[model samples]
Target chain A: MASTMLRTSALRSTIRATPTVASKRARLAGVSFVRGKATLPDLPYDYGALEPAINGKIMELHHSKHHNTYVTSYNQAIEKLQEAQQAQDIAGQIALKPLINFHGGGHINHTLFWENLAPKNQGGGEPPSGSLSKAIDGSFGSLDAMKQKFNTALAGIQGSGWAWLVQDTQTGSISIKTYANQDPVVGQFRPILGIDAWEHAYYLQYQNRKAEYFSAVWDVVNWKAAEKRFK
Target chain B: MACNLTPLISPQALEPHISAQIMTLHHTKHHQTYITNLNAALGKLSTAVSTSDITTQVALQPAIRFNAGGHINHSLFWLNLSPPSSPDAKSSAAPQLTSAINKKWGDMETFKSAFNTQLLGIQGSGWGWLVKEEGKNDLRIMTTKDQDPVVEAGLVPVFGVDMWEHAYYLQYNNVKADYVKEIWSVINWKVAEERFLGAQKNAFGMLKASM
Candidate 1:
């Protein structure tokens, strides 16, 4: 059933611009909107897109397994939350909030992270452009300084967390911060660049030497997505 | 005043929008029901039931969690609410909580807008909360149904608006959403900041307490 949906979605992509009016309407509303939930998106590029910097094995585990776990948990939590809310079981609803945060966060962050990488030799490395470049320069002095600061902060993570280059909403200035576990940056900042520092993120590749993994991540840093976030 | 809890709203203070009679009944009768239910649930637990099994303990967690939650939530609600303030109180000097809201949300109005947006999304009996995400000091919206404590979600709830039927059923009847929309006028931002600061200081300890 899942593969059938994927096939039809792929077919819809191929016949773009000249789609049937009915299909276009369905597409505009989202095919999954009919069911009220969407399946996990397929990775845009191959698992090997970020090879060496992030091994194929890590990408495979991260996407197929870790991300899937979050997706499953998020769906289950949503169902439970809906049930609790319907019963006016405030206690039950409150009890399920952590599952929502942990699983919902996992779904959100990993979805962003997947699009934020590409093959090392592809359009991944290069400096950011336009206003994003200027913003980085304005906030952190230079691109290299921003990179060094982000890496340094990420490397210093005490335990499982994410190091992020985020935009401060009040000042409209870019800043870097880290979140313990799966907590998103929430209201104070909009995340522009994030590095997954969880042990599962890089333990197999770099072992205890997180610094090495942090250094390698720069090779495939998705500057384009970060640039879009700035604009 | 009826329950002997300190009420920030006096009888004369709520004269215009909410009659003193209703306020008295709400505080004395409706709020007491939640507290009574919670205590009854706690009192019924046998010693063996309390110590027997971890799964049983986790399962029974919600009775205490919710009733206590409802009591604490309603207590805050009574303190937060007031009759539509006269222009004098509305335009009074900005309090510390307004400044804190500025730090988190840019301004009081923006914060209220966001808070109301979240509150309206509470589909059934639950609460809309403005909480400081632990360690990050960021303001975020969280909805908890029934009696879930704000901290259980790993966010330190700074302020909460209860949307349970009992909270507004007498006044608003079936229109819970309208009640939620209207309640913003009476929010006591000063108290919210006090809660926020308190939560920030003790968040790490709270996390450890759960362990």
Candidate 2:
């Protein structure tokens, strides 16, 4: 009986959140983000703040353009997904998932991507302090050791993916993990830091050399921001 | 990459007791097909993302969810079996993984029996898993249907057993029970231990543990 109630509640939430095509389409035609739709987060600093490390052109493209595309597509997918559900189009909903995963992942990744970065002028590139720094030493032996291990793991990515510093649920210490494409760190592992390894992330400045990009991103890592996140 | 089809182990290691031909065909043919299928599924997922044709909810999600599950499950299945690492040893003993399992699940015999019993009870194609779940930091047993990962269940996978037919067909044919019994001989406890200790560390900092 309890399970049935839970299932009914789930079904109710699903129905309540069902998309209205009229509103969804109306919101999409506009350039601005809609409330309850996808909203473009405000940049903490000017677009050119993280110059040289992540250049103005890359930031402009990554944010105003690329992230916007994901936001638009995600809203559209959700709208269609709701319609499909309402119509009992099981086959249609099944088909729409990649868009949701990709675009939804795009939104998720970019949201973190923006906050994770900061200008070196504003204390970026600094290493973690306090318990985080100590934990880093304990797990990987030293800060440099952790960086080397992370770089090796990042460079080892065969294709487009993400390199992450994630909290292990059981151990409660940070560990470096890599995921191919947009596979999220997911579940209980809290993301302390993440570096995007997608070609678009560093293609303009570094060209094809991922290792160089991996090395360079360290300069604008926003360690102060990372330290704040650990708590 | 393509599954290393030629041969990974010597046939003579499991000989007389377990035939060389059976091991060869099982690893090279059956497991290889799963790898190929998994790759194909991933490729389809990529295509869906690129094309943007997935305008509905039902179209591409199932492919990504199901095929990714298939890939992960099959990959683990192939890694589960082996010939006894030493001649004098009990074929089923996995020295590397046993101590950790003992630490968590009481003792080797108990853990093995429980795991195999769960494996025997699976209603259909699914997996039997030993996962480490966090909450005071401990290992736990979890079973999942189809190809769903323990990670999705919010646990770190310590050990896994795939009950899918392709895993057992070449050797035991229709008799899954015999195949499950046979696989215990070659369990790689070493890799399992590494994963265990790694999970034991406050990895990625989400848990409340001291370094």
Candidate 3:
């Protein structure tokens, strides 16, 4: 009977997710229009820049291996999509959704992620100033409060995914969000801050201590980069 | 409501080949989400099933099926592995289960080859299973695509191996063949034997009811 029986969260988040399929289509259309030209973007700094927080080995593997794979795969997916469109291969185009969602999300999210971090001496760890600062305080009470909420979203992600701080471009209100796998947020919201929670993002350095990785990433927050987008 | 995650058999208890990190994350993060999502789907299903709103039920079928299957499969999978018994541990600890496996597949080595072949044939995310048909000594090696419950197909699952990329991706990466080849060392024959006995009794009980 001891061998016979075995056993086993209700999660809530405050952020209002208003996903628009039209905008999602718009983004996919834009990518597919470019055909096979999707190239991996360079890191804003050296691989070792976020050292003691994000390790060089992880950055190298992540960008070169992981992110590059996405870029390459996305380009291929788009090329196939174009071919399908020309042939009017409806089934083939439909079959490409999972591939597009995953790799497209990967390429798009990592592009934003690179810009979302800075070297410590530059602006990493520095909180937002000017209008974006006012907006953060208005939306989440304070900068630290926003980071606390962001951390919660990051930690609560059940699997490989990303925790994002996204702003509705129409109203400029901030929202905390999480997406599973390589699902990228597009349309209606401009991504302000993103924390990659995929194990590959930190497993080389943090192992199962994801909390430590979440804490360390705050030091490298690119508030200035985020501010430019905010303004 | 009927589905839940099984307590981990512990990470290190099943490893020298399988690492503690892989087991821990697979249990806590991956499997936990499946149960949580299954609970959420069931919460919705209670309404749909009660109302007999076939539209909502149809819309919700994939989520319910996927998550419920995830919960069921992982529950069984947890009981399927244990620490290696031998010092060198070149083999498994399943003499009794091995006899059943031998009767079914002619030998343990042959059974593994057939089972692993079924595992490799999985195109994407899925699970490989050893199941027993009701009211008979019939044992089958089968594969379910994408978190599909074996019970949904009307068979009693005795052992299962999760083949979702998350299950072994961290340790095995894209080389899933290595994972399938190595997984046999840790299968808990004891649990399989218990389930096998349980299956026979349940089958016999069904026959008696019909009579």
**TM-score for all predictions?**
0.46, 0.46, 0.63
Tens digits of per-residue lDDT for model 1 on A1-231? 355335434532321222355355556866432223323657766787788899887787778877787777777787677667768899999999877887777776776676566565656777788988998898899999988998988865533568888888888888889876677777978888888987567755665456888888988887876776674
Q: Chain A of model 3, TM-score against the native?
A: 0.83
Give residue A88's lDDT in candidate 3 (0 to 100): 90
Candidate 2 interface RMSD (Å) = 17.4
**Candidate 3: pairs in clash:** none
**Candidate 1 residues B100-152, lDDT tens each?**
66887898778778887777555334678777766555677778865566646
Residues B21-127 of candidate 3: C-alpha lDDT, one tens digit per residue: 78988888777877788889888989998999989988988777777667767777876676777432333444565677788889878988999999986644578
Ranking of predictions according to lDDT: 3, 1, 2
Candidate with the greatest DockQ versus the true structure: 3
Give the backbone clash total of model 2. Answer: 30
lDDT tens readout by residue for model 3, A1-231: 121111000000101122354346547776433322566666767899999899998898888887888777876787688879878999999999888888878887887787778779767898889988998899899988988899998986644679888889788788899987777888888888888987778877876678999999999988876776674
Error of 1 at B79 (Å): 54
The weakest ten consecutive residues by lDDT in model 2 chain A span A8-17
| Worst 10-residue lDDT window, candidate 3 chain A | A5-14
Off by over 4 Å in 3: A1-34, B1-16, B20-75, B82-158, B162-181, B184-211
- Residue B49 of model 1 has an lDDT of 72
Scored against the native two-chain complex, candidate 2 gets a DockQ of: 0.01
